[model samples]
Target: MTNNMKHIQFNNVSYEQWKEEAIKALKGKPFETLFTPTTDGITLEPLYTQQTVIEKLGDQLEKQISTIRSLKATKDFSSAQQIFGETAEQFFKNIEDSLERGNQILTIDSRVLFDWDETNISRLASILENNPFKLVLQDKNDVILTVFEQIEPSSRKQVSGYILSKEPIKIDNYPNVRTISANTLPYHYEGANVVQELALSLALAAKFANNENNFAEFVNKFYVNFAVDTQFFSEIAKLRAFKILWKAFTKAYNAESNIAVPIVAETSLRSFSKLDEYVNLLRAGNEALSALIGGADVFTVHPHDVLVKPTDKSIRIARNVILVLKEESHAASVLDPSGGSYFIECLTAEYVEKAWSLFLEIEDAGGIDAYEESGKLQRILEEVTTARLKSIEARKHSLIGTNIYANPEDDFNVETNPLFVDVKRLSTPFEELRLLYKNLQPKISILTYGKLKNFKPRADFVSGYFATAGIVANQSGEIDSIADLLNWINKTDSQYIVFVATDEDTKTILPSILENKRKELIIDVAGRFKEEEKEWVEKGLNGFVFAGQNLVEKLNAIAERLKGEQQ
Candidate 1:
């Protein structure tokens, strides 16, 4: 058993014991109630168990399944290997019971996704086959994605039908499946980015069509996303831009290949009012409407005041708002709700063109992997993100419940009638402290993106990194501007690991640096590196993000944080 496994033996504590003693130790632990983190965030469990899978789907399973299936026929049949009819029958009952018992948001943890001894995909399938849970396959290393071959034709047909089925009801692929989820949570939390999300998606979808072998299948598949954020129009514009870009991207590929790109909208975690908890619902509802009007396929806004432990009342009202939009207000059945306004189309198209251009720029830069390693992609994102942060800090761009209309009195301290925060919780204003300082320090970033053969870039990119970080840089080799920064980056303090980027940054440096240095080094890419330059960057690095983000901003943030420490 793993060391972590040795410690956790679950014997359910009585309410008072869990409340007053056991759960007390967990009060200050950091975890998002819902929505996965896009980058740097905690991964602690609110609770843990050896029996990872909940065997029974609780009480009201039958009714919920009947209701959902009655309303929507299942789509992606091949994907949902729910072979047991009785098990399938059991899932709906669990859903209704969980909902009735106040089990609002669902969970499928890492065990089913990643296990040391077993292949993740099959394991996930087993879990999935047993229970219909909403699982987010965000990590690139997810086990389910074992194959590198292009998606086949049969898969494409299944996916296309799946897309069409989701507009009104659920389909065959785990009729309960939320195939696409918006991952805006992490981007907003860490560096606060959006454009790359649109651009990279454009590139990947295109590459899936043009480059991959399974063009007959995977190319035809259209997946939607569920985004959770508090940005109103910015959120709306994001959805609008996605639709616009998909059209352009598809046009760039084979015509009439739309297949349908849908979006599932959620409220941003960064926007929750720590003060005015109630305003969160309003903000989320607005964001949802924007996504809805912007033509998203599915919409699930989070409960307001989720930053605090949510109450049953809060969840009820959050669902009610959607009900209002769907049933009472009649927002659900609308088509192309924002289709014709010149401002929206023009504005959305502008973002579309910008994203496409960015996509092309990535294509121009030699795809995803090449753009990332050269520090090209990270540098660009850094340039834009830095300006954004400056705007936010300067109050030029406003966050409704956050920076603007300040609420200082503990008036925002919400009621805890079954919704109180963990009394013994950790506290450091996420805005005020470096989350990593409690763990390790960070340094200037040089990303090795996409995939690389070796550890070559570390010696080259940091060539002049010292001077850039205001430290005198000295290198063992030539200090030309081309590879000096990369070499210099390698010289930074090791324990506090230098902040090299993730996607493009990981591999882009391999060939050049490896060849130049003549070193038998290894570049650690995620799995496989795309050979085509333009397509590589768009799909591989996803708009050139590295070090979990852009390089320069990472450098500046680390520098600023370090400088603050010295002060």
Candidate 2:
């Protein structure tokens, strides 16, 4: 009885049957509305199946599967957490704590070496003698090279890792250490879409290989670092696609096609917000897991408060995120955990095709160097950034705790990094709006009209919209006529008043309210009155706050009015 198994059967549904059922469930909604288009120009279907994969891959289905399956021989990866401290002793203590906890790679910024004394240098050298490490030497190579020379020869021989630098350095003594990187975090920060990040990274590596005397050696030593965002499945596909692209890239160069290019993935800070800092933990965790599942050789989960001042607790939590995913989830036990999924396989193939095409374009434009000099890449990034920010403002793109579902009571007075001041983060505009009016305590009132059922919805909408910018708005009692509305406005000391009522009531009541309202009081309407907006503005209405309106522009205008009042 224990060994025997009972057989169970269920009705098999075809794609058409499933579509019919889905349509019935949608309750008259259009089926086409379920389709989503990403910033990279890839349209995502609501459902994917084996047939869908065949349709997408066509003749290359088997080839794509084989390429992705061979991307990683083993699923294991090193946990590399970038350590930061003000002094050498603090840095060493942090390094020790990280290593003792679960950090496998001694990740360091070369800029820190400039402050290290002989004692700390020796301590770091001793750590390198026994452990693997990665040093990021962005424009600090000459000094760091001399610092490396100070390490004992025996220690250098035992060291194993890679160095992330734009300019290659010859460290022949350290045989296991590689000194070239194709880092795409910069592009990610500048708001490049997934395809751009992938293509730029390849173009960057190709640039390094072109400059090197030994192409094969450069390919062998080269590694890539990508910023894994919270796009979940798309991010996983992006990394897998890179592996296929790497193989194709090497084959094009006649180099060894099977060599696995090491990939280091870190959580992107593009979506990190300061208002509700705790939510950043969830964002980081989502990104970290995606990085691991996507087959990163080394992964880093940046502290949730990294954009601001990261505390020791935050850093420890970041380190443990990787530890928990790798240890408890047992994700590393199987090679290519996301392999063979119909949707992901299709996505990987699309990414490979698009990224390779963009790479060829970069090459044709004289590689990354000439492309950068031409400013074409910068202009493209700017356009993408503007579009993304517009999406966020329109509430089409959600960044919980920042642009949507924001916490008005949350404080944002914490210390921030001056260096990250210029990074074009998605939440920065909303955060700035919050910061501008947080201490000002601007008074905003929603002038309710008509029945509670009609006015309540618009009143709540106006309140929540203002709350996103950290301005709490008080709602007035129901008003039946123009006299009651004018009486309420006279008693209240609000600087900004919004008319909240149904479309019909708003059309009838707003013109009268604007005509009678004081000249100093800035007025706005909750519902869209686009056809009569010009007439209303001329009658003394400031603007309109509707569902699809840009919250940034609306909030900025309010902030400017507040600033003018203070002056």
Candidate 3:
């Protein structure tokens, strides 16, 4: 018996009995309704017991938790981040400044920013020696590598690795200098699900492992970087699963089980929004929390406006998010803080099983490179991205300030840098629609009919709906007669008019109101009356604003018509 449960007296309830009680509580709803399926098609149950953990993992669970708990209690994790600068001078300045502001290590993308010649390289080398801070290079070419080779072996020890290079290089196999990385960002940024990310990355690592003559030596220097999203517990489980699976993968090659698999976590840029960019701070904070709780060795919280040139304020907030997680929350002091939860453990097991299956399938299909060359990988990701986009469109997935509770007047005209991935963001369509609407100052009049109980809810819905696109809605008083509604709408300079009434009341007033209404004003109805749509449209209804309809498509059409009218 576990320590916590020892003193507690509990009824001996069978799974069947518990299920019966659950069914009764559901009140005639099917038990299947409680089983939710993830994007990976794994069905998550409403409850989990000790028996939920698989036999293979059962023996190691306590041991692994204990090991991680000890590490968390004893050691302090260092804060690390990429230096954001376009030029060599900016790079050096940013790195120096970052190290001064509590960052222990500075990572550089040599290809993107620091394209240095020998003289500048020597200067950077001098700075490194004097500063005595760790330097990580995302070296794409031989420029950084060649300079490192020139340095004596003792000085060269400070160079962590050329871990971020897309193309694999032939470097001397050293235990200290890691060359292999599970380059997960490409897959992650391009909208691959967590299972896909793990599976494809491990498959690539396995392909590299097979080519190496000394598999153990190659595995030793291997590291991984993950792009964490806002799915709080899922991301936490993802990182933990990576560690567990890495040990299993190494064991297959008859290698040491204790070999370390270093992980660097970065907040995902996929979910970042151009509208109401302040909300990006919340997204970054939540993602950073997931990464830290997941036991990432190094964490980077990208500036909220990373897609554009980040301001000084955004950078400080991003860095401070990590600092707060480490210092104030004391996250680093409790390794695998989510370790013992049944939900997390179950999710971790599911990811591991699904990911391992996918890895094997990739290997069987020749390899990771061969699998990619077939274009099948891209197709799968595209399908998933499409589904996610549709979810956002249907309001199944809510992105506040972008899709749902957006401030239409929010403007950001700053130039954005091109991203490495071609993946589509959920907010792209909504932002485009919003931009179209922004060009026109739209005023909507909600013609409320009948009693307050009959029309108030729909009037409120119309007001919020128009506000999402920055349109001003005038919904003053409830009108019992058609003349009053028409007079009120006509007195104000409203470009559009919407009827908010009960179905019976709508049928009674719409026809009479349409006859007297201004022909130039665009007309729409608030609720979905699919059978009455054709009759209503013939009587001059432009469209219906109903739940479950694609808001992006509807808004875009309206914005285009409004723009045309202005033209």
- lDDT: worst 10-residue window of model 1: 76-85
TM-score of each: 0.46, 0.94, 0.87
**lDDT, candidate 3, 217-334, per-residue tens:** 6766667778888888889888887877776787888864456667767888778877888898999999988888888777778787877677667777787888888878987877
lDDT per residue as tens, model 2, 1-567: 464445656787889999999999999999998899988879998989989988888888777767766767335777989888877878888998989998999778766533666677667777777888888775744455565666788667777887876667677677778788888878889889889999998999888888888777786678898988889999999999998898888887886557677888788889888878889999999998887888888987888888877789999999999899988888777677888898899899888889999999989999998998999899888888888889999888989988878878877755666545666788888888887787677888888988888778778878888889887788887788889998898878998888888888888888888887787888888878779989998998888889988999988888788777666
Off by over 4 Å in 1: 1-94, 97-133, 138-194, 207-211, 224-231, 255-257, 411-567
Alpha-carbon RMSD to native, per candidate = 25.0, 2.6, 4.3
lDDT over C-alpha atoms for residue 54 of model 1: 21
- How high is the lDDT of residue 524 in model 1? 23
Clash counts for the predictions, in order: 71, 0, 0
Worst 10 residues of 2 by lDDT: 138-147
Residue 306, model 3: lDDT of 74
Kindly give the stretch of ten consecutive residues in candidate 3 with the minimal lDDT sum: 67-76
Off by over 4 Å in 3: 1-35, 49-76, 86-88, 111-115, 127-139, 142-146, 171-175, 418-423, 451-454, 490-492, 564-567
